[model samples]
Target: PRLLRAAGVAQVVPPLAARDGRLHVPLCRQAGGLQLAVFAYITGRGGADAPLGREQWRQFGATLRAVHQTPVPEPLRRALPTWQEPGEVGRWLQRALPVWRRQKGRTAAARALIEVIGVRYDELQALTARMLALHQRLGERIAAGELRCALCHSDAHVHNLMVDQQERVWLIDWDGASWSPIERDLMFVIGGLSADLLRPHETEWFFEGYGPVQIDWPALATCRYAWAVTDVHAFAIEALGERDEARASSSAAWFERLFAPGEIVALAREGEAWL
Candidate 1:
């Protein structure tokens, strides 16, 4: 509490109503006796339905850069851990994988995801295995070198990022916060933006000041493909346990379209060829 106060966030905004996750809130101050609002990042004004624009994402990148400028005090820094640390991804994976691995497609909720996977069994299988391997291997790079350590929002998708009433970019959802490779942000931002089925270079606006990541292209491409599998599974998990069969199918369709193979070889080799 003292640390938060010291950081100038006298009071956090009242947490907004969230279904899956909400990133903005209202707040007040005690010492100053001021009623004000605060945000974890730029909160967009788009209601529940609209997505962010390309320029919006460019600003998001800028805000993310600004966040990097604020040196985290020792206590906070120590308190935060890399997302790559053990027990982190594993936990999310545990809850989600069961729904993903189910074959019978009996779980009415997972029908969409199962259908997506069912169509590309051989490809999805290879991709999933490769991604798991990379995570197992490169996760060590984080501990050893802290190569791309930054305060990552962790969940960098469109839903978490909102432009508030003032049109300032705010990244919400600290629940996924961690120190990690810059690519984590990329995975959410660039990787996610790709889901819109836009051309790869179309994202140049968002990449302006962003630095390069120390990525194994083949590895990342492999991981990217792996991520498609994982993300679809995640959506499936979220959609599962629900009574809405139509919505579940909708969920699966979203996964299928987003995770389709565009050019794995090209994406894998986007940087240096994977070793």
Candidate 2:
């Protein structure tokens, strides 16, 4: 956050410091045992479902460009983790599939998992395999030092973006920040990866603010598939592991939505053509 502010990324809402002078002070735990932290509040209107106008999309593009262009200090560079291919979905499925197959589906969570995975397991496995292969190719490129790394907001989806009263586009959620290929951020913009939030012309307007640059197609494809794979893994975990029924239902719904026509799964598969 400090680095973004220093780089003139005014869209970032500065966190309020706690009594101990720490910005992200951990507070009480939620029912799910997740630690809650407080931060500076911004008066904004946009949310995950908010429709962004052309200007808003352009500003979002510019703000993200600023974030990617921010220089990483030596200490920060060393501390930040580099991008890696996602494998949790594959691993989790490998371990859970056999168990799920054998279970009588007595528990609600077990039933939910079985119902979600039973029909789509093969499709999920095939997609994961394709993504893993793409990642392997990406790994070779990384080893050959063919890609450039930048500060990236790895989860820069619509939910993480907001528009203030002055129409400034604010980027929230920094927990997923990492040193990754610029494509890590770009993938969410160019493809339908923004969940179809930005129209085709709006995407062009976004590039107007972002300016010209060469796109690393291989890196972009990997990032896109990685996001899909990671989301699948995360939602499946929430559906099967979350004790709260409401949360579990929400996860299951999102997991189902991922496979809807022209949704994330199809979008990710479309990325293979770029390879």
Task: Give the winner by TM-score.
Answer: 2
**Global CA lDDT of candidate 2, please?**
0.76
lDDT of 2 by residue, 188-245 (tens): 7777564555457867877887888899988898888888887887777677776677
Best by lDDT: 2
Pairs in clash, predicted candidate 2: none
| lDDT (Cα) of model 1 | 0.52
Q: Write model 1 residue lDDT over 1-275, tens digit each, in one string.
A: 22232444322222433454543333544435643334344343631246456666567666565554445777777788664453344445545454565755645657656665556665655545555566666666656764546666555655655567765555555565666555656654454435343345535655664444344344344345445545545565555644577776666666665544543323433423453
Q: Provide the lowest-lDDT 10-residue window in model 2.
A: 25-34
